[model samples]
Target: MLQAKVAVVTGAGSGIGAAIARLFAVEGAKVVLGDLAEGGAAFAAELADDGFEVMFQRVDVTDEADVAALMQATVARFGRIDILVANAGIPERKSPIHQLDLDDWRRVIDVDLTGVALCNKFAVGAMLATGGGAIVNMASILAHVGQENSNAYSAAKAGVVNLTRSVALTYARQGVRANCVSPGYVDTPLLAQLPAAVRQAMLLRQPIGRLARPDEIAQVVAFLASERASIITGACINADGGYTAI
Candidate 1:
Protein backbone atom coordinates (compact mmCIF):
# COMPACT_ATOMS: atom_id res chain seq x y z
CA MET A 1 0.00 0.00 0.00
CA LEU A 2 2.92 2.35 0.74
CA GLN A 3 5.44 0.91 -1.65
CA ALA A 4 8.23 3.30 -2.67
CA LYS A 5 7.73 5.48 0.38
CA VAL A 6 10.53 6.50 2.72
CA ALA A 7 9.15 6.98 6.21
CA VAL A 8 10.31 8.28 9.60
CA VAL A 9 8.58 7.41 12.88
CA THR A 10 9.69 8.86 16.21
CA GLY A 11 9.37 7.07 19.57
CA ALA A 12 9.61 3.85 17.61
CA GLY A 13 11.26 1.85 20.39
CA SER A 14 7.89 0.63 21.64
CA GLY A 15 4.12 0.81 21.65
CA ILE A 16 2.26 2.66 18.90
CA GLY A 17 5.39 4.04 17.27
CA ALA A 18 6.92 0.59 17.07
CA ALA A 19 3.73 -0.81 15.58
CA ILE A 20 3.65 1.86 12.88
CA ALA A 21 7.30 1.26 12.00
CA ARG A 22 6.77 -2.46 11.61
CA LEU A 23 3.60 -2.00 9.59
CA PHE A 24 5.13 0.49 7.20
CA ALA A 25 8.03 -1.86 6.54
CA VAL A 26 5.61 -4.64 5.71
CA GLU A 27 3.96 -2.38 3.14
CA GLY A 28 7.28 -1.83 1.32
CA ALA A 29 8.38 1.49 2.75
CA LYS A 30 11.99 2.01 3.83
CA VAL A 31 11.50 3.15 7.41
CA VAL A 32 13.76 4.99 9.87
CA LEU A 33 12.83 4.46 13.48
CA GLY A 34 13.97 7.06 16.02
CA ASP A 35 13.75 6.72 19.75
CA LEU A 36 15.36 7.86 22.99
CA ALA A 37 15.31 4.31 24.31
CA GLU A 38 18.10 1.77 23.87
CA GLY A 39 15.77 -0.89 22.47
CA GLY A 40 15.21 0.97 19.23
CA ALA A 41 18.29 -0.52 17.58
CA ALA A 42 17.30 -3.99 18.67
CA PHE A 43 13.86 -3.55 17.16
CA ALA A 44 15.40 -2.29 13.93
CA ALA A 45 17.63 -5.35 13.80
CA GLU A 46 14.65 -7.60 14.25
CA LEU A 47 12.78 -5.91 11.43
CA ALA A 48 15.77 -6.09 9.12
CA ASP A 49 16.11 -9.79 9.91
CA ASP A 50 12.67 -10.22 8.39
CA GLY A 51 14.02 -8.74 5.14
CA PHE A 52 12.51 -5.31 5.65
CA GLU A 53 14.00 -1.94 4.84
CA VAL A 54 14.48 -0.38 8.27
CA MET A 55 17.03 1.35 10.53
CA PHE A 56 17.17 2.99 13.95
CA GLN A 57 18.44 6.32 15.21
CA ARG A 58 18.77 7.75 18.71
CA VAL A 59 16.92 11.03 18.71
CA ASP A 60 15.80 13.60 21.30
CA VAL A 61 12.82 15.12 19.53
CA THR A 62 12.92 18.27 21.63
CA ASP A 63 16.37 19.06 20.30
CA GLU A 64 16.54 20.74 16.92
CA ALA A 65 19.88 19.10 16.15
CA ASP A 66 18.65 15.59 16.88
CA VAL A 67 15.52 16.01 14.79
CA ALA A 68 17.55 17.40 11.88
CA ALA A 69 19.94 14.50 12.13
CA LEU A 70 17.05 12.04 11.97
CA MET A 71 15.77 13.50 8.73
CA GLN A 72 19.25 13.77 7.24
CA ALA A 73 20.10 10.18 8.11
CA THR A 74 16.81 9.06 6.58
CA VAL A 75 17.44 10.91 3.33
CA ALA A 76 21.01 9.66 3.21
CA ARG A 77 19.84 6.09 3.60
CA PHE A 78 16.57 6.10 1.64
CA GLY A 79 17.12 8.93 -0.87
CA ARG A 80 14.19 11.09 0.29
CA ILE A 81 11.43 11.26 2.86
CA ASP A 82 7.80 10.62 1.88
CA ILE A 83 6.13 10.18 5.24
CA LEU A 84 6.68 11.46 8.79
CA VAL A 85 4.98 10.34 12.01
CA ALA A 86 5.68 12.72 14.88
CA ASN A 87 4.75 10.30 17.62
CA ALA A 88 7.37 10.93 20.29
CA GLY A 89 5.80 12.26 23.51
CA ILE A 90 5.51 11.84 27.27
CA PRO A 91 2.50 12.09 29.54
CA GLU A 92 2.48 14.56 32.39
CA ARG A 93 2.01 13.43 35.96
CA LYS A 94 -1.55 13.72 37.24
CA SER A 95 -1.70 16.55 39.80
CA PRO A 96 -3.93 19.34 40.88
CA ILE A 97 -3.27 22.79 39.40
CA HIS A 98 -1.71 24.18 42.55
CA GLN A 99 0.35 21.06 43.15
CA LEU A 100 1.69 20.85 39.58
CA ASP A 101 5.42 21.35 39.34
CA LEU A 102 6.54 24.00 36.92
CA ASP A 103 9.30 21.74 35.65
CA ASP A 104 6.84 19.00 34.86
CA TRP A 105 4.57 21.32 32.98
CA ARG A 106 7.44 22.75 30.93
CA ARG A 107 8.84 19.34 30.17
CA VAL A 108 5.56 18.05 28.79
CA ILE A 109 5.11 21.13 26.67
CA ASP A 110 8.59 20.82 25.25
CA VAL A 111 8.41 17.13 24.43
CA ASP A 112 4.81 16.87 23.31
CA LEU A 113 4.39 20.21 21.59
CA THR A 114 7.77 21.70 20.68
CA GLY A 115 9.11 18.33 19.69
CA VAL A 116 6.40 17.96 17.10
CA ALA A 117 7.16 21.38 15.72
CA LEU A 118 10.81 20.47 15.27
CA CYS A 119 9.89 17.27 13.46
CA ASN A 120 7.56 19.14 11.13
CA LYS A 121 10.11 21.85 10.41
CA PHE A 122 12.83 19.43 9.38
CA ALA A 123 10.48 16.99 7.67
CA VAL A 124 8.97 19.77 5.60
CA GLY A 125 12.33 20.72 4.14
CA ALA A 126 13.09 17.12 3.26
CA MET A 127 9.63 16.54 1.80
CA LEU A 128 9.86 19.67 -0.27
CA ALA A 129 12.97 18.22 -1.85
CA THR A 130 11.00 15.21 -3.07
CA GLY A 131 7.87 17.12 -4.14
CA GLY A 132 5.65 16.28 -1.13
CA GLY A 133 4.84 13.98 1.78
CA ALA A 134 2.35 12.92 4.46
CA ILE A 135 2.62 13.73 8.17
CA VAL A 136 0.44 12.08 10.81
CA ASN A 137 0.69 13.51 14.31
CA MET A 138 -0.45 11.75 17.46
CA ALA A 139 -2.85 13.71 19.60
CA SER A 140 -5.25 12.40 22.24
CA ILE A 141 -8.97 12.19 22.97
CA LEU A 142 -8.09 14.30 26.01
CA ALA A 143 -7.44 17.10 23.57
CA HIS A 144 -11.17 17.59 23.24
CA VAL A 145 -12.12 16.91 26.85
CA GLY A 146 -10.78 17.86 30.26
CA GLN A 147 -9.75 15.70 33.14
CA GLU A 148 -8.82 16.94 36.61
CA ASN A 149 -5.09 17.02 37.37
CA SER A 150 -4.18 16.23 33.75
CA ASN A 151 -4.07 19.72 32.36
CA ALA A 152 -0.54 19.55 30.96
CA TYR A 153 -1.11 16.52 28.79
CA SER A 154 -4.43 17.72 27.51
CA ALA A 155 -3.03 21.14 26.67
CA ALA A 156 -0.07 19.76 24.76
CA LYS A 157 -2.23 17.50 22.62
CA ALA A 158 -4.60 20.36 21.96
CA GLY A 159 -1.62 22.33 20.70
CA VAL A 160 -0.77 19.50 18.32
CA VAL A 161 -4.22 19.70 16.73
CA ASN A 162 -3.83 23.32 15.78
CA LEU A 163 -0.19 22.91 14.83
CA THR A 164 -1.21 20.22 12.34
CA ARG A 165 -3.70 22.53 10.73
CA SER A 166 -1.14 25.28 10.36
CA VAL A 167 1.33 22.90 8.76
CA ALA A 168 -1.28 21.65 6.29
CA LEU A 169 -2.20 25.14 5.22
CA THR A 170 1.40 26.29 4.85
CA TYR A 171 2.23 23.43 2.51
CA ALA A 172 -1.12 22.51 1.06
CA ARG A 173 -0.16 23.66 -2.43
CA GLN A 174 3.36 22.33 -2.01
CA GLY A 175 2.26 18.71 -1.60
CA VAL A 176 2.44 18.25 2.17
CA ARG A 177 -0.59 16.81 3.92
CA ALA A 178 -0.70 17.10 7.72
CA ASN A 179 -3.33 15.66 10.00
CA CYS A 180 -3.91 14.65 13.64
CA VAL A 181 -5.19 11.37 15.05
CA SER A 182 -6.81 11.69 18.46
CA PRO A 183 -6.99 8.34 20.15
CA GLY A 184 -8.93 7.39 23.27
CA TYR A 185 -7.51 5.08 25.92
CA VAL A 186 -5.33 2.44 24.30
CA ASP A 187 -3.97 -0.85 25.57
CA THR A 188 -0.37 0.22 25.92
CA PRO A 189 2.31 -0.13 28.57
CA LEU A 190 1.32 3.30 29.83
CA LEU A 191 -2.20 2.13 30.38
CA ALA A 192 -0.92 -0.87 32.27
CA GLN A 193 0.76 1.46 34.72
CA LEU A 194 -2.54 2.91 35.79
CA PRO A 195 -4.25 1.57 38.89
CA ALA A 196 -7.00 -1.00 38.40
CA ALA A 197 -9.69 1.49 39.25
CA VAL A 198 -8.35 4.05 36.79
CA ARG A 199 -7.93 1.45 34.08
CA GLN A 200 -11.44 0.14 34.54
CA ALA A 201 -12.80 3.63 34.52
CA MET A 202 -11.12 4.37 31.21
CA LEU A 203 -12.44 1.14 29.72
CA LEU A 204 -15.95 1.93 30.85
CA ARG A 205 -15.65 5.34 29.25
CA GLN A 206 -15.01 3.79 25.86
CA PRO A 207 -18.31 2.89 24.23
CA ILE A 208 -16.67 -0.23 22.81
CA GLY A 209 -16.14 -1.46 26.39
CA ARG A 210 -12.47 -2.09 25.67
CA LEU A 211 -9.30 -0.17 25.15
CA ALA A 212 -7.84 0.18 21.65
CA ARG A 213 -4.99 -1.99 20.53
CA PRO A 214 -1.79 -0.27 19.48
CA ASP A 215 -1.98 -1.96 16.09
CA GLU A 216 -5.49 -0.63 15.55
CA ILE A 217 -4.28 2.92 15.99
CA ALA A 218 -1.33 2.07 13.74
CA GLN A 219 -3.64 1.01 10.94
CA VAL A 220 -5.45 4.35 11.03
CA VAL A 221 -2.09 6.15 10.94
CA ALA A 222 -0.97 4.04 8.02
CA PHE A 223 -4.04 4.94 6.01
CA LEU A 224 -3.47 8.61 6.67
CA ALA A 225 0.11 8.32 5.46
CA SER A 226 -0.84 6.78 2.12
CA GLU A 227 -2.01 8.22 -1.15
CA ARG A 228 -5.31 6.50 -0.45
CA ALA A 229 -6.00 9.55 1.71
CA SER A 230 -4.98 12.02 -0.99
CA ILE A 231 -7.66 14.58 -0.36
CA ILE A 232 -7.28 14.56 3.41
CA THR A 233 -5.37 17.39 5.10
CA GLY A 234 -5.65 19.44 8.26
CA ALA A 235 -8.32 17.07 9.59
CA CYS A 236 -8.38 15.35 12.98
CA ILE A 237 -9.64 11.76 12.94
CA ASN A 238 -11.21 10.74 16.24
CA ALA A 239 -10.05 7.17 16.78
CA ASP A 240 -11.80 7.17 20.14
CA GLY A 241 -14.30 4.30 19.79
CA GLY A 242 -17.27 6.69 19.96
CA TYR A 243 -16.12 8.24 23.21
CA THR A 244 -16.60 11.72 21.73
CA ALA A 245 -19.81 10.84 19.93
CA ILE A 246 -21.79 12.00 22.92
Candidate 2:
Protein backbone atom coordinates (compact mmCIF):
# COMPACT_ATOMS: atom_id res chain seq x y z
CA MET A 1 0.00 0.00 0.00
CA LEU A 2 3.03 2.27 0.39
CA GLN A 3 4.43 1.80 -3.09
CA ALA A 4 7.17 4.27 -3.99
CA LYS A 5 6.62 6.29 -0.83
CA VAL A 6 9.51 7.48 1.30
CA ALA A 7 9.21 6.33 4.91
CA VAL A 8 11.41 6.75 7.93
CA VAL A 9 11.28 4.44 10.96
CA THR A 10 13.13 5.28 14.15
CA GLY A 11 14.49 2.48 16.38
CA ALA A 12 14.55 0.34 13.28
CA GLY A 13 17.42 -1.79 14.47
CA SER A 14 15.28 -4.49 16.00
CA GLY A 15 11.94 -5.58 17.40
CA ILE A 16 8.81 -3.79 16.25
CA GLY A 17 10.66 -0.95 14.63
CA ALA A 18 12.63 -3.37 12.51
CA ALA A 19 9.47 -5.20 11.60
CA ILE A 20 7.82 -1.99 10.49
CA ALA A 21 10.83 -1.10 8.38
CA ARG A 22 10.80 -4.49 6.68
CA LEU A 23 7.07 -4.37 6.00
CA PHE A 24 7.18 -0.85 4.67
CA ALA A 25 9.99 -1.74 2.33
CA VAL A 26 8.22 -4.85 1.14
CA GLU A 27 5.18 -2.75 0.46
CA GLY A 28 7.37 -0.63 -1.84
CA ALA A 29 8.41 2.31 0.35
CA LYS A 30 11.91 3.65 0.12
CA VAL A 31 12.61 3.15 3.83
CA VAL A 32 15.17 4.86 6.01
CA LEU A 33 16.06 2.94 9.17
CA GLY A 34 17.27 5.20 11.96
CA ASP A 35 18.70 3.72 15.13
CA LEU A 36 21.63 4.10 17.49
CA ALA A 37 22.32 0.40 17.27
CA GLU A 38 24.78 -0.80 14.63
CA GLY A 39 22.29 -3.49 13.76
CA GLY A 40 20.30 -0.96 11.75
CA ALA A 41 22.88 -0.84 8.98
CA ALA A 42 23.05 -4.60 8.73
CA PHE A 43 19.28 -4.88 8.76
CA ALA A 44 18.97 -2.25 6.06
CA ALA A 45 21.53 -4.10 4.02
CA GLU A 46 19.56 -7.29 4.48
CA LEU A 47 16.43 -5.58 3.21
CA ALA A 48 18.30 -4.14 0.26
CA ASP A 49 19.54 -7.60 -0.61
CA ASP A 50 15.91 -8.60 -0.83
CA GLY A 51 15.46 -5.96 -3.53
CA PHE A 52 13.80 -3.29 -1.37
CA GLU A 53 14.96 0.30 -1.33
CA VAL A 54 16.39 0.93 2.13
CA MET A 55 19.07 2.90 3.97
CA PHE A 56 20.37 3.17 7.53
CA GLN A 57 21.43 6.14 9.60
CA ARG A 58 22.43 6.27 13.25
CA VAL A 59 20.29 8.62 15.32
CA ASP A 60 20.03 9.70 18.93
CA VAL A 61 16.42 10.64 19.18
CA THR A 62 16.92 12.62 22.40
CA ASP A 63 19.30 14.95 20.60
CA GLU A 64 17.38 17.43 18.51
CA ALA A 65 20.25 18.07 16.16
CA ASP A 66 20.75 14.36 15.59
CA VAL A 67 17.07 13.87 14.88
CA ALA A 68 16.90 16.88 12.60
CA ALA A 69 19.90 15.56 10.74
CA LEU A 70 18.17 12.21 10.35
CA MET A 71 15.13 13.80 8.72
CA GLN A 72 17.33 15.99 6.60
CA ALA A 73 19.41 13.06 5.47
CA THR A 74 16.27 11.12 4.60
CA VAL A 75 15.02 13.92 2.37
CA ALA A 76 18.45 14.25 0.82
CA ARG A 77 18.43 10.55 -0.04
CA PHE A 78 14.76 9.97 -0.90
CA GLY A 79 13.68 13.44 -2.02
CA ARG A 80 10.64 13.59 0.34
CA ILE A 81 9.27 11.79 3.35
CA ASP A 82 5.83 10.31 2.94
CA ILE A 83 5.62 8.47 6.25
CA LEU A 84 7.32 8.47 9.65
CA VAL A 85 7.18 5.90 12.44
CA ALA A 86 8.46 7.39 15.67
CA ASN A 87 9.34 4.19 17.49
CA ALA A 88 12.57 4.91 19.32
CA GLY A 89 12.20 4.46 23.10
CA ILE A 90 13.77 2.93 26.17
CA PRO A 91 12.19 0.64 28.72
CA GLU A 92 11.10 2.16 32.03
CA ARG A 93 13.23 1.86 35.12
CA LYS A 94 10.90 -0.01 37.44
CA SER A 95 10.25 2.07 40.54
CA PRO A 96 7.41 3.53 42.49
CA ILE A 97 6.73 7.24 42.02
CA HIS A 98 7.96 8.07 45.50
CA GLN A 99 11.08 5.99 45.06
CA LEU A 100 11.68 6.68 41.40
CA ASP A 101 15.07 8.19 40.73
CA LEU A 102 14.63 11.55 39.05
CA ASP A 103 17.35 10.73 36.59
CA ASP A 104 15.69 7.51 35.63
CA TRP A 105 12.41 9.29 35.03
CA ARG A 106 14.17 11.83 32.87
CA ARG A 107 15.92 9.12 30.91
CA VAL A 108 12.69 7.40 29.99
CA ILE A 109 10.93 10.68 29.31
CA ASP A 110 13.76 11.91 27.14
CA VAL A 111 13.80 8.86 24.92
CA ASP A 112 10.09 8.13 24.90
CA LEU A 113 8.27 11.45 24.99
CA THR A 114 10.81 14.01 23.92
CA GLY A 115 12.13 11.73 21.20
CA VAL A 116 8.68 11.47 19.66
CA ALA A 117 8.34 15.22 19.81
CA LEU A 118 11.65 15.74 18.05
CA CYS A 119 10.78 13.22 15.36
CA ASN A 120 7.42 14.87 14.91
CA LYS A 121 8.91 18.34 14.82
CA PHE A 122 11.20 17.61 11.90
CA ALA A 123 8.99 15.06 10.16
CA VAL A 124 6.12 17.54 10.10
CA GLY A 125 8.42 20.19 8.70
CA ALA A 126 9.55 17.84 5.93
CA MET A 127 6.00 16.70 5.26
CA LEU A 128 4.63 20.20 5.13
CA ALA A 129 7.17 21.13 2.54
CA THR A 130 6.07 18.21 0.40
CA GLY A 131 2.33 18.84 0.75
CA GLY A 132 1.80 16.56 3.78
CA GLY A 133 2.25 12.95 4.91
CA ALA A 134 1.38 10.41 7.60
CA ILE A 135 2.93 9.64 10.97
CA VAL A 136 2.57 6.64 13.33
CA ASN A 137 4.00 7.06 16.80
CA MET A 138 4.57 4.00 18.93
CA ALA A 139 2.82 3.99 22.28
CA SER A 140 2.02 1.17 24.73
CA ILE A 141 -0.94 -0.34 26.58
CA LEU A 142 0.52 1.19 29.75
CA ALA A 143 -0.69 4.51 28.41
CA HIS A 144 -4.22 3.43 29.17
CA VAL A 145 -3.86 0.95 32.05
CA GLY A 146 -1.55 1.43 35.00
CA GLN A 147 1.53 -0.76 35.29
CA GLU A 148 3.24 -1.33 38.60
CA ASN A 149 6.65 0.32 38.83
CA SER A 150 6.47 1.67 35.28
CA ASN A 151 5.29 5.16 36.09
CA ALA A 152 7.62 7.04 33.75
CA TYR A 153 6.95 4.87 30.70
CA SER A 154 3.20 5.16 31.13
CA ALA A 155 3.44 8.89 31.48
CA ALA A 156 5.61 9.24 28.40
CA LYS A 157 3.36 7.05 26.32
CA ALA A 158 0.35 8.96 27.56
CA GLY A 159 2.09 12.11 26.44
CA VAL A 160 2.60 10.55 23.00
CA VAL A 161 -1.12 9.88 22.65
CA ASN A 162 -1.98 13.50 23.30
CA LEU A 163 0.96 14.73 21.32
CA THR A 164 -0.35 12.78 18.35
CA ARG A 165 -3.77 14.33 18.80
CA SER A 166 -2.30 17.78 19.07
CA VAL A 167 -0.28 17.36 15.91
CA ALA A 168 -3.21 15.88 14.05
CA LEU A 169 -5.44 18.78 14.97
CA THR A 170 -2.83 21.41 14.32
CA TYR A 171 -1.93 20.06 10.90
CA ALA A 172 -5.17 18.51 9.68
CA ARG A 173 -5.91 21.29 7.27
CA GLN A 174 -2.30 21.23 6.15
CA GLY A 175 -2.65 17.59 5.01
CA VAL A 176 -0.53 15.87 7.68
CA ARG A 177 -2.13 12.98 9.53
CA ALA A 178 -0.82 11.75 12.89
CA ASN A 179 -1.76 8.67 14.85
CA CYS A 180 -0.34 6.14 17.34
CA VAL A 181 -0.41 2.42 18.08
CA SER A 182 -0.54 1.09 21.64
CA PRO A 183 0.66 -2.47 21.86
CA GLY A 184 0.38 -4.87 24.78
CA TYR A 185 2.88 -7.55 25.77
CA VAL A 186 4.75 -8.44 22.63
CA ASP A 187 7.34 -11.14 22.05
CA THR A 188 10.21 -8.79 21.36
CA PRO A 189 13.79 -8.86 22.59
CA LEU A 190 12.88 -6.38 25.30
CA LEU A 191 10.55 -8.92 26.87
CA ALA A 192 13.17 -11.65 26.80
CA GLN A 193 15.06 -10.09 29.67
CA LEU A 194 12.21 -10.65 32.12
CA PRO A 195 12.16 -13.78 34.22
CA ALA A 196 10.37 -16.71 32.68
CA ALA A 197 7.66 -16.65 35.34
CA VAL A 198 7.04 -12.99 34.68
CA ARG A 199 6.82 -13.68 30.98
CA GLN A 200 4.32 -16.42 31.58
CA ALA A 201 2.30 -14.16 33.82
CA MET A 202 2.14 -11.55 31.14
CA LEU A 203 1.21 -14.11 28.55
CA LEU A 204 -1.60 -15.41 30.73
CA ARG A 205 -2.93 -11.90 31.08
CA GLN A 206 -3.42 -11.56 27.36
CA PRO A 207 -7.01 -12.40 26.46
CA ILE A 208 -5.75 -13.66 23.14
CA GLY A 209 -3.90 -16.42 25.02
CA ARG A 210 -0.52 -15.28 23.75
CA LEU A 211 1.75 -12.31 23.53
CA ALA A 212 1.52 -10.44 20.24
CA ARG A 213 4.24 -10.83 17.64
CA PRO A 214 6.22 -7.73 16.74
CA ASP A 215 5.13 -8.01 13.13
CA GLU A 216 1.48 -8.01 14.20
CA ILE A 217 1.98 -4.60 15.77
CA ALA A 218 3.93 -3.54 12.70
CA GLN A 219 0.98 -4.45 10.53
CA VAL A 220 -1.18 -2.02 12.46
CA VAL A 221 1.44 0.69 12.08
CA ALA A 222 1.75 0.03 8.39
CA PHE A 223 -1.98 0.35 7.99
CA LEU A 224 -2.03 3.66 9.83
CA ALA A 225 0.76 4.98 7.64
CA SER A 226 -1.05 4.15 4.43
CA GLU A 227 -3.95 5.85 2.71
CA ARG A 228 -6.02 2.86 3.83
CA ALA A 229 -6.33 4.88 7.02
CA SER A 230 -6.64 8.18 5.21
CA ILE A 231 -9.42 9.38 7.49
CA ILE A 232 -7.73 8.25 10.70
CA THR A 233 -5.82 10.96 12.51
CA GLY A 234 -5.24 11.80 16.15
CA ALA A 235 -6.37 8.25 16.94
CA CYS A 236 -4.76 5.56 19.06
CA ILE A 237 -5.40 2.10 17.70
CA ASN A 238 -4.91 -0.68 20.25
CA ALA A 239 -3.04 -3.78 19.09
CA ASP A 240 -3.09 -5.16 22.60
CA GLY A 241 -4.74 -8.55 22.36
CA GLY A 242 -7.44 -7.27 24.72
CA TYR A 243 -5.05 -6.40 27.55
CA THR A 244 -6.82 -3.09 28.11
CA ALA A 245 -10.27 -4.55 27.65
CA ILE A 246 -10.39 -6.25 31.02
Provide the clashing-pair count of each candidate structure: 0, 0
Give one digit per residue, the lDDT tens place, for model 2 in 134-185.
9999999999998787888999999999999999999999999999999999
For model 2, give the 10-residue run with minimal summed lDDT.
Answer: 89-98
Q: What is candidate 1's lDDT per residue for 114-159, written digit by digit as tens?
A: 9999999999999999899999999998889888789789999999
Q: How close is candidate 2 to the true structure, as a TM-score?
A: 0.98
Q: Model 2, which residues run further than 4 Å from truth?
A: none
Let me know the TM-score candidate 1 reaches against the reference structure.
Answer: 0.98
- Residue 129, model 2: lDDT of 99
The most accurate candidate by lDDT is 2
User: Where does model 1 exceed 4 Å of error?
Assistant: none
Error of 1 at 69 (Å): 0.4
lDDT of 1 at 148: 75
lDDT for 21 (candidate 1)? 95
